[model samples]
Target: MKSTDIFLEILGCPSEEMHEPVNAGYICPYTSDRCSKRGHGTNDPFPVCSIWKYTGARENRRKDRPVIVCPKRFYTADIVGDILEHVWVGPYERNKINAVREIKMGKIGNVDMVVCDTSNLPALDNFVSVELQAIDITGTVSDVYTSHLSQTDLIRSPKYNFNTANVHKRYLTQLIKKGYFHSTWRKKIVAVIQDVLFESIRERVRFAATNPKDENTSIVFMSYTLDPTETDEEGYYRLKLKEVVGTEHSVLMNAVVYETPPSKDLFVAAIKRQL
Candidate 1:
């Protein structure tokens, strides 16, 4: 099936264009275009406005510059969630897809996305944690620096070094803190990364999956490529999951228990000085 079909099935197409007459005394926040109505309304949750389109088009016209503002930026998370639901969960699993954007787990800080079963009361069981990273990994150092020093700098910067130890550390930290490694329920962590970035860290991912300190947890890596040539009817770039790799111990890693530290606040003080 065409990639567009998958997107359409999961997200549905954008709502048809609204042709409602503008209310009197209405002004466009973006372009200052006067409207016949006081407010604007559209059936589509994500309505395409002329301002965004024009800006994106203008940015794309610059051959030497990076196109930072595009439709893919907005729908990437939704697309990933849909792909996970269809490809990983499938119809047989009695699971509900939940996309938690920035949930905090102890010291691990904010996690990207998490999918879990809704039928189960305790949402931690039978879940998958996904981290999505989308960036142009092919740009030369100079090109990247010119576009935005902050964009790809994390991958090579001395402090962040995103591709090397940081990726594994962050992923493992999230898995451990989320109880994915310690829970007695089925749990998996998937990292959805761009193809170029995935290649740079494929070795690390393999090593981590192969030699997980905690034998009970498994990590899966899925790489996606955006086809510059292929776009949907809406002119949005098409994305394809190029590859998926998981460790041989994936099955064995299920339902293993890992101990967690005691909460200091929950326990009584060791000594009472002067009650």
Candidate 2:
């Protein structure tokens, strides 16, 4: 099936019902932590499975407000590792893959996750740095709309869309810096993002693919969503990851050199105050 059709089908389905436990023997794919029956927003110490929580509550409500929770936490590194093992890399070789979470690289900061082929250890080329970015889907509607208008009217706009601008600054920029640091190693970086930032992400990818640059970087974009039809024993939605854009060498190379303004301190501080 077409990627667009899959995206629409997943989005149209109710988030809570997307993944339902077929039997009592199914296991939670996210983590090994024991699953609890407590609903979200309670003070219960036991952690509930993410699939059991309501991911589309904002969509169902009349307020149109953004969900404050981070979606990345729901789809943790282990889950990402499983997806990469079974889907991107063949399951036969999945045993060779090792996933490490929150590993700090010198100067580049703590990356969300890193996947490496254990058989090829000490070879940086075998390592893939993964970054997870989940933006507030409903919160930046006005900004996204404005960005679309500017694009259609041929107006000069900012380098990144307001909604995902921070993601570019915080995550993608760090990947570029790491690429320069490990230029000889030729490590690959993958950025996994939610589908809500699709248009903004495509714009960034198009700009990068068309532009010429000197950095020999390899980056990939993986878009993920909850599977509408299946779930685990914990009744959490299954995740589906797809390569949406920027898997080409030309795109990755140019994308790494895209100019990023050093306004993170100010921007982050402002956002924190608002929160």
Candidate 3:
């Protein structure tokens, strides 16, 4: 689907754009020959009124520089001293909006970029902790045993401390505190398990004395098994599992639905359509 369609579905309108320019024709550019104030900007050399100034870069301009114009109301404000909203239109524009999140577990740090919708803000608050499991059917533990030896030595290898000051953990915390995740508790739990399993695999790799050179490479393959519901001493509700056997890493990662603000014209049009 077109990104714009997704945008409209989420934000309910087009994305807002600022600083467009409009052309003036066959009249006093300043007031378009309708102004009662003759003294203001009347001496301006440009054919287009100073009030209707072009705000776009030369690259953004059409063949006619006067083609670029901001909203009439925004320009009128310069004379009448009133502020109004502005808008723009382009077919191929890519909206550059996203949410950045960071999560850390002992020695492992993760940064995730989540794209947002222009309409939904509340969805940003929910996420599921995904846990992964390594697929090994040997039962003989030969490969597991070989890897375990190598992992031990690697864990003791020197490592730089990671920076995580800007990471926002509130989203995960709120999801757990609120009940929105209750609907997907089983899925959430499986996700949490995946995280724990990965951490375990990492720890095992660190235990292996062999250095893989780059720390960023994945040492093992893992996958998720969805378990959306859990029942226990605490009354069962949708739950995001937090622990796996013995590990310090938090398996809880949040999933959020995001949105951008609607375009000014689309917003106004919607209001008019309703009225």
Q: After superposition, how far is residue 37 of candidate 3 from its true place, in Å?
A: 81
Candidate 2 lDDT for residue 105: 81
Model 1 has how many clashing residue pairs?
8
Q: Which parts of model 3 have CA positions greater than 4 angstroms off?
A: 1-136, 139-191, 194-199, 207-275
RMSD in Å for all candidates: 15.8, 13.2, 31.3
Give the whole-model CA lDDT for all candidates, comma-separated.
0.40, 0.45, 0.23
Q: List the candidate numbers ranked by TM-score, top first.
A: 2, 1, 3
- For model 3, what is the alpha-carbon lDDT of residue 20? 18
Give the per-residue lDDT of model 2 (tens digit) for 52-170: 11233334622221221244344532444544643243232567877787898876587777877676557634566777766532222223223322333323322211346666556
- Any runs in candidate 2 off by more than 4 Å, and if so which? 1-71, 74-92, 120-125, 136-162, 208-217, 227-230, 247-275
Candidate 2 root-mean-square deviation in Å: 13.2
What is the Å distance of residue 228 in model 3 from its true position?
18
Candidate 3: what lDDT? 0.23
